[model samples]
Target: MTAIIHDAVIVTGDDEDTVHYGASIAIDGTRIAAIGPNAELQQRYPSAERIDGRGRMVMPGFANTHTHLTMTLARGVFEDLSPPHKPPFSGGLSPIPLPDMTQDERRVMAQLGALECLRSGVTFMLEDSSDIDDYAETLAGSGLRFLFGERAYDRTGTAIGDPAPFQLDRAMGEKHMATIERTFAKWNGKADGRIRIAISAWAPDMCSPELLKDLSALQSKLGTWITIHLNQIWGEVAAVQAHRNRLPTEYLADLGFLNDKVICAHCRCMDPREEKLLGDAKVIVAFNAAIAARRGLSPRIDSLERQGCTITMGSDNMAEDMVEVMRTGLFMERVRREDGRNPTPEQALRWASRNGYKAFGMADGGWLAAGNKADLIVIDTQRAHLVPMLRAVSNFVHNGQARDVQSVMVDGRWLMRDGKVLTMDEPAIVAQAQEVANKAWSRQFKKRFDKPPAGFSPAALP
Candidate 1:
């Protein structure tokens, strides 16, 4: 089916960062067929289905390069809690513990995350999690492109950021390696190539040298992409230094894991030397700004970009809103460097879209251009806050919210239209997520403490 979206402001996130007013885009199947002035396209595709784009701004959809999809279950509980940074740092990423969930429950939770992604205009994402086989099909069915990383690690006795001795479990590493292979065999390139599989060693501190070497070899063998959490927090840096006698980036580099195809997430706590190493290796850094800011941290994004490392954005934990991620990244970097004029909105938008797509191996996506993949979003500018839209990209970047997204299209299909998701039941998913979260937290509290936690009544569970 052919569809023409006409008479809107089009932000083509191309090399020149083109902005076309009163423009139109034609989509044929899974690719963009043509783009030009509205009147010109209207006459060119006279028989195409017309989508009125009046009072709307169309642009490339956001790409989230790092996220824990099922961690949406920990939204309210973990956002406010973070690992201690001072002396006597525990080896856990968060003060609150996540509730154990069954495979079916995980699938439901992941679906909930996908619902948020579609609503928030995230067309593509790279999800870092273990045993993704459970929810791979469910996520693929959500009508969003995904790269699922089957995460593996050898340090199992303690959580990340714990100040305890490192324990390497070779058996656990082997099992995870096997799981990665199985996940690739089962889900890689599924959903008509909308779903791809990648390799993940959970974190530099949590993985042993042997496991890292094996994972690197497996990645080369499979010729797949790789992602890992590198120097995310002070505690992680300390742990890696204590165990490896080198910086986290140095350790990974020695393991032959730092390369162009590797996407290293949360490089917030790194030094100039490490940045230089990553840049020299031509790695893609997943600058997860929202979560970093929430955790009282921010990466030197400008430095990394200047050093020749590609900068991409991710929502990370607790949320999946790439709009928030993009804006937060921009603001955080500006504050970090105290340069309001540098790292403009257009650069941030490119990082959130095209850079992430390139990191995930979709060079043709994350941009609005003829012959590019039709992964784009339409935002309704007919809102109180978005009025006086003198600058389309600037206004949307600084003042826009996710609610302004009126439509989202991926692979030439309307996943969301008129502020509604087409592939998933929105209300039902929200209600189910609330129920699951409440029950799971309650059960966890009761199981661990043998009683309901303060302010949480057991009677609330049905």
Candidate 2:
């Protein structure tokens, strides 16, 4: 298959961060055949189908390094349920309980999240969750490049951020390892090599020392990447210190688990020494900016990058808008550094796209170049917010919205075109997801609380 997206603005999220005007992309099969002037590409691939890009801008799709597709069900409610940062910390992100659902309902929510990702021009994603295989079918059919970081942990009586005493269950830990292996065996190379499964340690405080060592060894044996939640909050930091007698980063480093292949999410509540060690290990930091903002926290992205760590971006749980993630990351870092122009929009675009592609081991994608993977998006440039594009990339970085993305392509295939997703039934998924969420939450919230939050509305959410 061959096609030409002719006459568009090309923002190459590459190391050079090049932006080419009035250019076209020639895609042959699953790779980009060329990138050149409109006349040149049209003359080169005469027989190819031409996609009119007259008022559109073409750029690499986003790489969401961490997210929970199934957890999308926690959207409106969980954003406000962030855990406490002060003393006497609990292990999990929030003490609030989420409604339980059947596997079918979970699948619907995952599909809805996938719909959101496609709509937002997220071509690549890394989903960190337990029993990820339950939703592997949903992801496999979504036409998105993704890494399923299957979670494994052995701690009983608590979750990640709890300061409670560690209670290790070797049998349960063994079961999780077995599940990881089974999932890998079943789905690692599926989806024409688009879907990959990676090992994940839940968090520093949740996994025992022996469990961490075993998971690390397993990762090496499988020749795959690993991800973890590290320093997500002060409570989490306290929990790790109380249990392992060391900081979170120190615990991972002491077990020889910190490496270039590891993707650490939420390094917000870190000690200076921990930051230095993470930089020394050269791990890729998954700056989950939106969730951090929701939790009133932000990572030291600039310091981590300067210290030798590769910085990338992720949407994290309860959200799927990579556009928001990228923009929020830029704003957060600027405020953290107190510099108006320190981490430029170009830098944020690099972290969100190119850096993330490399982190997921898809080095050929996430950038526009000949012979690279044909994973890109087309945005409508004629919108009111996108007018007067004197500085194309700058304007996009500062002002682009997810709704502006009208088409998405992965490996030369149209996952979405003209604002319509091709791989899934969008309307059915949306309606079914809403139905499931409403029924589930209505039942759970009623069972738990006597009344809704102060200004309760009978019609807000029945």
Candidate 3:
């Protein structure tokens, strides 16, 4: 299939921070064939299907580096609890244990999360989903790029249901390994290399050292990625410190798991040594600024960049909007630096685009250029927030939102066209998700009353 997008302002990351006006891009199958002025491309490929890009700013679609897709079912389910006031890791909301999730529930939740990603201009996602045997099957036809990391834990009573400590017995380990192998064989490199599988060990506190070591070995043997929740909260950090007498990053490093293939979701509490170790290991930090702000945690962007760690954007919670992630990242860095001009708009754009592909191991993606993957986003420049566009890129970082996303394409295929989804039926997905959520909520009516005497209303089940 050949696609030619014409008459657009192209934000091509081929050059450092450059946007070409009155340009066009030609996609031959999954790769970009040419990128130049519209007149030249039209002359070159006269018979190609023309996609008029008038009044649009075309850029690369976002790569969400880290997320828990199935957790979409828990969005509002735990917001109203008494805030974790324990010192050190003393903030952020907690999710209610949802042991009642069936395969159908898992499918619906995964679809809902994928729907949110599509709507929010997310071209790719790295998800840490639970131990649902059919997780990949549930997501098989969803038509979004994904890296499904099958969750692993060896702690007893830690997962949602068991009254005793959470532990993965040998039988459970074999089951998890077999399921992951099958998932990898089925979904890895599917949708034209848009999907893959990873080995996910929840956290140091959640997984035993032996399990962590085993996971690292399997990740290396399978030549896939490893994702872990590292230093997300202060409690996790404190627990690691007490157990290993080292920071979480240092401990992971000691285990030989903090390498380039590892995408650590949040480095909210990383110190100088840990930052250096991450950079030395070439680990990418999935900078989820919005959810971090919601939980009162922020990344050390400047320091991380200085240490040469690749930082990419992600919407950790159901806050699936990438524009909000970009805006939050820009503002949060400035506020943290206490200087208005700290993180330049150009830098913010890089984190949201090019660096995102780096985190996803898609070096040829997140850029608009010849020979790159045609994962593009077309923004409506005519919108109110985009008007008076003296500086397009700067305005994008400062004022843009997801609704400004006019179109989206992944692997040269039009997943969305002119602000409408094409791969999935939006109305139908929403309706089905709402029905499932309503039924799930009704099943446990009093599960709602466990809310704090003083706090926000509990998040209803999805």
10 residues in a row with least lDDT, candidate 3 = 157-166
What are the TM-scores, per candidate, against the unseen true structure? 0.97, 0.97, 0.91
Q: Report every candidate's CA lDDT.
A: 0.88, 0.88, 0.76
lDDT of 3 at 333: 95
- The number of clashing residue pairs in model 2 is 4
Per-candidate total of colliding backbone pairs: 5, 4, 10
Cα shift from native, residue 171, model 2 (Å)? 1.3
Report the error of model 3 at residue 9, Å. 0.6
Model 2: per-residue lDDT, tens digit, 1-462? 789988899998777788888889899999999999989888888999998888899999999998888788778767887888898776677666667878888889888888898899899998888788777887788899889998899999887788888898989999999999999999998999999889989998889899999999999889999999999889888998898798999989999999999999989999888889999999999999999999999988988998999999998888899999999999999999999997999888888898999888878988999999999999999999999887887798889999999999999999999988899999899889878887877777677763444443343355
Candidate 1 lowest-lDDT run of ten: 453-462
Candidate 2 is scored at a TM of 0.97
Q: Write the per-residue lDDT of candidate 1 for residues 377-401, one digit (tens) a residue.
A: 9999999999998888888999999
Off by more than 4 A, model 3: 77-85, 88-95, 132-135, 159-175, 445-449, 452-462
Give the Å error, residue 192, model 2.
0.3
Estimate the lDDT of model 1.
0.88
Cα error, residue 246 of model 1, in Å, equals 1.3
